[model samples]
Target: MKKFSLLSNRAGALFLAPGAILVALFVIIPFFWVIFVSFTNRTLLGRTAVNPDFVGLQNYLALFNPETFFTRGQFGFSLILTTQFVILSALVGQALLGLLLAWLMQAVPKPLKAFTETCVIAAWILPEVVIGFAWFAFLDYDNGTLNGILRSIGLPGADLLLQQPFWVIVFFNTWRGAAFSMMLFNSAFQSIPPSYFQAADVAGATSFQKFRDIALPLIRGHVVTDLILITMWTFNVFTPFILTHGGPSYRTELLSIYTYRVAFKDFEFGKGAAVGVIIMLINLAFALVYLRIARSRNKEAEQ
Candidate 1:
């Protein structure tokens, strides 16, 4: 018993030590630094003054200030609306599309399976920057592939990008990003014990009943994970805003873009950091909810 305990202790240390060190170095250290910076009045200027004074609560208080550049009161309101749009567009849109694609993959013929899976993976494997640029060209009003097709049909090609910033970003993001959920749901769907599905089918279940009763319950864990990941990614997307430049009067300004404009563009390091910290807190809350849901579902599964 003593020898086994010693061996187990050694093995645990061998694996966990590196991971613990990394977590401390990367996550804990950076988080402490951000907390420290938030309590200071730092600037981006080259003058090396000790301006990041230990001004406690000043930065936090500035969050409520109206005239403050970094914690612009208006950005808070915008963020509320921004979050709503992104959460709806990403979570709902991705799930519906991903499930449809996943189901379709199962129904498609064997010869075509390899081709379609490759296409789905090809989209996911593309670099995000590359995807962003490709979408830019595809959506460009003057020389866009979309407009080109409309013109080929001898119809007036509307300036889709200029006219619909909200839907444009939502559409582009949904189109490019749905593949992650697709792959996840596909894997989850594939892993279910065949008996659950077969039982459902034998019970005179329609396709919808089979999906709702058997498919959704078995894949709920993956669904929760996808929801959390997609929600965080969508809300924090800086790439789309960078490409769109939050144009057409800030129509596409999600939380990330709003924070960027505050911190870097406005040069309010404290206020900017405050916004960042607020966003981090929001993510943390979502993470907690996600874990809770996962735990509850897991407990139910075990029972």
Candidate 2:
């Protein structure tokens, strides 16, 4: 029995070793390295050149200075804009729409459900660059499909890309990403027993009431998981860089774009690392909030 157990333990470690090594190599090591780099005055060129000196929190201080952060077209504004984009596009747009689609799918016929699932999955699996280019063409000013439709209907077509760049990107991200959330919710909903819904119907509960009282409570865990995943993904997304290029005077320049500009474009490696640290902290904050909410929901469900 001892010999057999030893072999089983060795087999389990073999399966787990690959994933553990990859995480340490990619996620864990890089996370601390970025933090270490943030405290040094690193530069790709000029006097600092090859060797970087320790500057403590100078990079952070400079980044958060009154003029730098508060200025209309600066780091502070970029952070604020990115927050808005994540909240609206990921939290509200994708989460709400995906949940609705999942609920709607429950009542859809099998044929329609399969077709819709295929379409949604197709969108989800397509390359991010392809989605960006597709949206770019769809929203182009003059000869785009959207403008063509507007002109056919005797309406004046405006340059949505230039006029509403931020919202356009938000909508674009939501459309491309909602399919994941929808599939997640669908899976969660499937695990729910139908007896609860039947009981609610027998009690003469309305659809909204049933959803609020039954589905919401049961799917709380999945909702929390889906939101955290989408929020992080949306916050860090660089796909819109292909579409908007963070252009139109930096109006849609998210924090990730801002970090890229400061680090690579400006050759200020230290400041960029500081920005990277800040974004990491922000993501950490989101994860904490999600975990707290999930914990509370779990406690309530247990009671």
TM-score quality measure for candidate 2? 0.87
* lDDT comparing candidate 1 with the true structure: 0.77
Per-residue alpha-carbon lDDT of model 2 for 78-107, expressed as tens digits?
988998999999999999999999988987
Q: Spell out the clash pairs found in candidate 1.
A: none
Model 1 agreement with the true structure over 260-288: per-residue lDDT tens digits: 87778877677677778888998898889
Misplaced by over 4 Å in model 2 are: 1-22, 289-303
- Steric overlap count per candidate: 0, 0
Winning model by TM-score: 2
Question: What's model 1's lDDT at 135?
Answer: 83
User: What Cα-based lDDT does every candidate model obtain?
Assistant: 0.77, 0.90
All predictions: root-mean-square deviation over Cα?
Answer: 3.8, 3.0
For candidate 1, what is the TM-score?
0.83
Clashing pairs in 2: none
